[model samples]
Target: MFKILFQLLAISAAFVLTAPVNNSTTGISKLNSQQYNVVPFGHVDLDDYLSNSTTFANHTYLSAPGSQNGLERRGSVHACQGSFTKKLCITGSNAANLVGALCHSISVALEIQSGNHNCADTGVHSVSDQTQGTVYYKYKTTGKGCTTTAEPGTIEGALHKFIKEKNQDKICDFVCIRLTHGGNWSGYVGLGTSQDAVKYSRCDHEIGSWSACVNGDKGDR
Candidate 1:
C-alpha cells in the first residue's frame, strides 16, 4: 500500500508540472506575442518588455501603432502594446530613474531653441508613430495639482532631456502618467520615484485623439 501510494503521488506531481501553460489560467501566457515581437517602436531592445504583454493595462498611457526611428510596427489596431506581460515587466521600471538627467537636457534644449534660461515649468514632449496623432508631454514638475506654471521654452527640449536621461539607464519601453480626480475620490495617487520598480508598473487607459494630446492640467496616466 505504501509503495502504491508513493507512486500515485509521484505521477500526480509529474502531471501537474508537465502540463502545458495556457492563457486562460495564468495571465502571463496570454500575451499578444506576434504584435510585440514584430513591431518596431523606439528600439528592438524593447522586445524584452513586449514579451510580457499580459499587463499592459497597468502602466502605460496608451499603445498606438507606427514605427520610431524608421522601423515599422506590424499591428493594425490601437490596443495597448504589451498588456500580457504585467508580471514579468514589473521587474524593471524600463526608464523611470533618468528623470533628473532628462530634466537637465531639457534645460539646455530650451536655451538653444527658445533662448530661455529657467527650467521651472519647462515641460517635455514625446510622441511615437505608434499613436498616429497623439503627442506626449513630459513635465519637469507640476504645480499644486500636476499643473504647469508656464512654458519654460521649447517643448522639444524638455522631451529630449527626458528621453536622453531615461535612455542613459534603461530605455523607456513603457511609460505611465497619472491623473488626479479630485474631491475625495479614492484611487492610486501616483507611484513614487523610489518605489519598487515593478510594483505599479502597468499602463493606464486615458488615451485621447492626436488633436487633444496636449497637456492641459492633468497628471500622468
Candidate 2:
C-alpha cells in the first residue's frame, strides 16, 4: 500500500511539472519530403544568382545532378504552398560555424502579387534545411537584436532545434545555415498564405496543421 501510494504521488507530480498551459500553435502545411539538388547561388551566373539566390558564398562550383547547370550541394525540397504567391522550400545539412543567428540591423519589405522584384539592396526570401517532420520554436525579446530582425533568427532557431532532435542526440548535424543576408529582414513567424503570406505566418498553418490547432487532425485520423 505504501509503495502504490508513493508511485501515485510521483506520477501526479510529474504531470503537474510537464503539463502545458494555454497551449497554442501556428504555421502552414508542410510539403512532402523530396530530394532537391540545391544550386547554391555561388554556382549560378552572377545575374541568375542575384535574381534567384538566398545566400552568397565564394566557394567552388560543384555540380549537383537534377539541379540547374548552376548548383553545388544536393538538398531536399520541403514544400511549395500559396498559389498566386508560392514559396519553394528546401533544406540540407551545413558545416558548423558557417550559419549565422546574429540579429543586428533589420528592415521589413512587402511585395503584393505584382512584378518580378529583386531584393539585393534589402533581403532575399531563400529557404534553409531542417530535419524531416520538424518545426520552429521561437523565444524573442526586444533590445536583443532579435526584435527588428526576428524572422530569419526564428527560422534558424527552429531549424537548429529540429536538426538536433532528428539526429537522435548526435552532434554530426548540430548546425543549420541560412541563404539570405542583411538588408532584407522580416520579423514575423506565424501563419502565411499565398494570398496573405504576411499575416498567415506559422509553418504549421502554411504546411497544414499543428497538434495544438483546434481543427488539427493527427496523422492517425
Candidate 3:
C-alpha cells in the first residue's frame, strides 16, 4: 500500500499530456483561504470503516481521445473490501495498521471527520489504466460552510495553492498528498512545505473547465 502511494505521488516525466490552458471560469467560489481545523486522526475500526459503501461520485471524466497523460477513467469501482483484502493479504494487527493508513489518506483528502464513512467508504475504488500505470482515485469533500476557513491542511486549501502556482490539476493525483503517517494525532492545518510537492502530483480534469474541488462550493457533477 505504501509503495503504491509513493509511485502515484512521484512526478513522472514519461506521461505527457497536451494540457491546453483551461482558464475558463465557472460558478466556483472565490480564493479567499484561511486555516481550517480538520478532524483529528484517531483509532479507527478497520472492519467497521471498510463496511460503509464508498461513493464513486468523484473523478471528472474528460474526452482527450489522443491525449496520453490525461486519459479519463472508465467504469466504476470494480471491487472493494474483498479485493482490498486479497490485494494486500494481511490480517490481525498488521491489517489494522494498514487499514488505518488507508483511512487516514482518504480522510485527509476529503477532510472527513473520522466516523463519516468507513473502509469500504474510503478504500481505493480503482487502479490506474492497465497500460498507462496511472492510478485514479474518486473522492467527495465539501466546502459548504467554508467562508474563509477550511479543514486543516485542506486539500481544498491545497487546491487554492495549486491554482495560484499555475498547477495543472495534478495535486489531486498524488496519493502521498492525500496520505500521511497514521497515529500522529496532530491537528496540523497545512502540508507544511510538502504542499509544494503536491504540485508534482497529478489531477486529470478537463483542460478548459474549472470545477470546484469541493462538492458544495463548485464541484459540478
Candidate 2, poorest ten consecutive residues by summed lDDT: 212-221
Q: Whose lDDT is higher: candidate 1's or candidate 3's?
A: 1
Give the alpha carbon lDDT tens digit for every residue of 1-96 in model 3: 999877755623333211122223353343222211111111101111112223333333222212223321221111110000012112213232
lDDT for each candidate structure: 0.25, 0.22, 0.24
Question: Which sections of candidate 2 miss by over 4 Å?
Answer: 1-94, 98-152, 167-206, 209-221
Candidates, ranked, lDDT? 1, 3, 2
Against the correct fold, how does model 1 do in TM-score? 0.20
Model 2, global lDDT: 0.22
- Deviation from native of the Cα of residue 13 in model 3, angstroms: 35
Better of 1 and 2 by TM-score: 1
Query: Which tens-of-lDDT digit does each residue in 1-221 have in candidate 2?
Result: 99999997875542221111222223444332331111111100111122223432323223331223433232111111112212422132332221222110111221211011332222113211232211121111112232232233323333333322322222221111222123222222221112122212222111321110000000100
Cα RMSD for predicted model 1: 22.2
Task: Report the number of the highest-lDDT candidate.
Answer: 1
TM-score of every candidate relative to the true structure = 0.20, 0.18, 0.20
lDDT of 1 by residue, 3-60 (tens): 9999978755422211121213333333344423321112111111222122211112
